[model samples]
Target chain A: MDKLGVAEGLINRRKLLGLASGAAAAGIGLALPELVMAAPFEGLVERARQAGERQVVVAGGTGAYGDLVKKHFYLPFTEATGIEVVPTGGGYGEKLAKLKAMTSVGKVEWDVITLSIDSLTPDVTSLLRDLGDCAGLPDVASQGVDGSCLREGVMFDIGGGVLAFDKRSFPEGQAQPAGWADFWNVKAFPGPRALPNIGNPWWALIAALEADGVSRDALFPLDIDRAFRKLDEIKPHVTVWWKSGDQSQQIFRTGEVVMAMLFSGRAFRLRGEGIPLGISWNGAPLDAAFWAVTKAAQHPNAALALLDFIYTRPKAHAEFAAESFGSTAQRGALDFLTADAKASSVLQPANWSNIVRVDREWLAANREKVLQRWSMWIAS
Target chain B: MRAKPLAGSPFGGRPTSAQEYGPGLSLLLVTPLVLLLVGGFLYPVGKLFWGSVFVPEATFANYARILQEPLFLLVLCRTFEIAFVVTALALLLGYPVAMAMARVSGRTAMLIAACVLIPLWTSVLVRSYAWIVLLQRNGVVNNALIETGLTGTPLRLLYTQGAVIAAMTQVLLPFMILPIYSVVRNIPDDFVRAARNLGAGSLQAFFRVTLPLSLPGVTAGVLITFILSLGFYITPALVGGPGTLMMSTLIGQQTTELLDWPFAGALAAVLLAATLLLVIVFRRALALNKGFKLG
Candidate 1:
């Protein structure tokens, strides 16, 4: 009986040790994948390959822009480097917030993120690693990259907010609105208008000041009080304050608003769809979208490789620009763009001179205060 | 007449029953769920509350700003106002459905239940989009209205305060229905029959006995609907116009557009506090009504 008891005790102890070791194994298993995923990808291309980590995630806008990036940039990059590229779509603000949260938590998921000029502020730049020394970084200045993309990010495509109106409302032989001044002329325009309420209100504010007779050169350091007064004049007539790109498109599609401030690419798409859309590029703010590598990216090398691939291969850049109705910053890419595409592009010489470049730095600095005032104005 | 032995009592004098494992064993069984709630819900909420004071320096500045700012205050009041309207509409619409469900059985009950629940299964975005289609200027409703000669021009129905309430009520109606259905179903038919036999009309029996008994469920439904409506963002955002700014919308702007986490947290904390205070007041009022009945 005593011998039986000793055997049972030994069996119990062995069971306890087995349970403990199993738990330890589970803990290690849980932690190991995150460690491998979080490791830097720079100068570790061979190591990454050995580990079979060949996928890089890229986050950008949805719909047409996302499709263009996938078809032209991601596919070509993957074909060249044998690394798979995954594209994730979200709003510009959402992506920025996600990146900030992910970096704070030290578990970066996206390798490359497309950012707006306004999002390239100091606070955001601090979270991004300077790509100056990234392998195969392009000469953005020589390539005629927009000023917004000259630092920190690779400027991929350029589009601007243009005054687009329903052709049905302002058809052939009708006096179409030409610029911000014409847009603010309610008596002449004589229809409900829409303006973007997304992100910063800089576009609307600048346009308002311009309508109020503030010259382009003296637009910066915007007079807030004066802008509000001008906005109030048109507020009663402004029917829709569109909050998304899709919503802006919808407002026009449904004929809810006769005129709207819309992204040029969307206007181009609408025109292509035979939607009878009229686009006025005069006084439009030239906006550039840039691809930047996250500081905590797990696949930084692959991201850098993709960025280089986009710039060096002018055909892919031009293809994306043509299909998406956006302008490529790479000068070499322009050679591949068809005459029709070039005519539609804001970067074309005739349209380029009429568009205004938003002072991103000034806008970034005053973003908070301006947004506060904007919200107050909207509420009032 | 010495309280002549209660019917169905096995024991003569005092009843003897099996002892329960008590609170200790019950708590032990619930430990995993408690831990999950603590780790998941409570921890994040605690972190959010902490973030409010700590960000941009550990100060009450964020809270102070929210309290002082007229915009924040206006948004808060608007949030509550919307929630109140939504809750009242849900209760009104849902009570009839719940009554019908309680009255029916078998296939009919299942059909009613499915009607209530199928919407819950669908995505909120899809439902909101559906509302847009039905309410837009040139949408189905407006076309019908124009064809029927209701008005010469289509009414602006898509982005009005009424649209928000309608959509919210539709989305939250199920929440209000299920609770009342369960309670109304459980009420014994004998009570209403007895009331009728005692020379009471059917409606009088319903008002005196059925409605009073169903107050618990009504209270639960109202509380649930009101709280859920307060945090509603998408429905209001899609269906309502810029004029229909709610607390959650402001919080979203602060978090995403402005990257003002501290201020967002502060706004959330204020909202949470208000909800809790309202809940307490509601419960107190309920308890007082019950006390009056007992007295």
Candidate 2:
């Protein structure tokens, strides 16, 4: 009887495993349509050949950004012009140094680069091609003319740093923190907090001052020393200094900390995942992630076309925005957003209005000094 | 003309070119390895060390900056202190476990050995996450503690220095154990028997006869654990608070966030120098120990 019972159990276990395998196979089968749809874009290679353009290498295109560039830019460009996008992502300084190093060695590999203001601000004038030359191109000029996108490189997305909190950790009917000031306030709320482990301590410092009753406009002529003092007070309370957006979400989900400073879209993703995360847009600093053609690009025209395509395709912009939790530079891009995407994203005008427009040029120039002081201050 | 063929009677075989070509052959065999070491490791390290001082016009500014800042010294001291404590803990825990494994017979010993290695094989990140789950307020350890009436509340175990030490020790203990195990296994039974014949107690025999013989392995384990602990980033980052941030993480932030390669390289050079110095000192001390010479 025992032997028979064991055999029955074995048969049931096998059936369960078989069911799991079948489901996995079905998942692969479901993805086949998307693969088939993307297949036609391969014609871009022949088009590129006909146009006499060689392969183009797209640097810093490895992450989701890289994936997007490949799908929307590389594949289409290859079909249209025959150039290939090579994806490479590393630390911004390291990547720039590598590019610089390659140029010095006369072995430049990347044809295009997608960089943020933080990356392109300092030496970008030298590293990047003057897309200004391509200003006559309608799509390029249109996308590139947006307030944050700037005069040179085209802005692809409006990303920012926002305060994210776990709603469940806070009491019901209590006022949610509306900004950085409230994020640093511990006594009233009383829980562990996490902060960004990187970047300007300036934001948190500003938040601390605001918590102490300083206004937003007073941030400049920055009581740099006073900000450090303010940060020092709150430093002990931070449980985890999160390194990445994903780490921030994980911290929230695991209840590692009640609140955190996070990338704007991560909070949206957490809410989608059913975590009770709330984004407080008040005093959120807006940052821009822009794309530019590398000086060494072999297919600058196709790269321009890729940029134009992104600007012109409202649907694609909308889809990217919906997935990434940021907004497109195109004015009417929000019309395509789903209700769920709009409700959670920081892209809405109301949220965008609350964000302080950061002076990227000033920030970039003084960033090194600010960071050194911040690191020293944090350790102290 | 033969001149006794240069008296090649050292071996029965005829004189071969290999005998005369020993140095050249050795150089040929070692050249690739040396080139690899120089190109892959030395060049980067040399560049870092040089850049630290040279970037600001051959100034000692980087070194001076480190000295002038109390935070750097404090972190460096704390890092060494933590590494020392971790090394002591690893030796304490690992020595007995290794001894037990060496003494025990059959499948159970192999199973325990496998269990130790299993954790080593698993991703450090995965283990750290598991630790977070286990150590959280509502997690298994606290729940068990509460249920057993050990405490009225769950102790905060996830983000303390204790947590960092505990996690670090767990991760580093295997490195300490394997070397000691190899040494302990070779300890002849007759030595202990001989001690017993001299009317020494079992504890005495262990302390005098057995212990000193195991010093080489213990020394090796200490070196491994100490050096490994110095470079620890992930464990402390996951299980520790702001105060627990180490030199490596600080260097990482410098590169990724500040985009300050020169400073990052400087910090790395400092850490590398400190570790190398410690290892050298440790080797000299070990060499002076008389038992090690025979062992």
| Candidate 1 C-alpha lDDT tens digits along A219-248 | 888888898889999988787788888888
- Root-mean-square deviation of Cα positions for candidate 1 versus the true structure, in angstroms: 15.5
Please, what are the lDDT tens digits per residue for candidate 1 over residues B61-166? 9989987778888889989999999999999999989989998899999999999999999999999989999998788888999999998877778877888999
List candidate 2 stretches off by more than 4 Å.
Answer: A1-63, A66-113, A120-149, A291-316, B1-59, B121-126, B136-138, B146-155, B250-269, B280-295
lDDT of each: 0.78, 0.71
* TM-scores of chain B, in order: 0.90, 0.87
What's candidate 1's DockQ score? 0.34
Best candidate (score: TM-score): 1
lDDT of 2 by residue, A195-311 (tens): 886665666765666666767676564566777777777777776777667878887777778888787777777887898877777777666667676777667655555555556
Instruction: Please state the error at residue B272 of candidate 2 in Å.
Output: 4.2
Off by over 4 Å in 1: A1-115, A119-156, A186-191, A290-318, A330-343, B1-20, B55-57, B256-259, B291-295
Instruction: Evaluate model 2: give its lDDT.
Output: 0.71
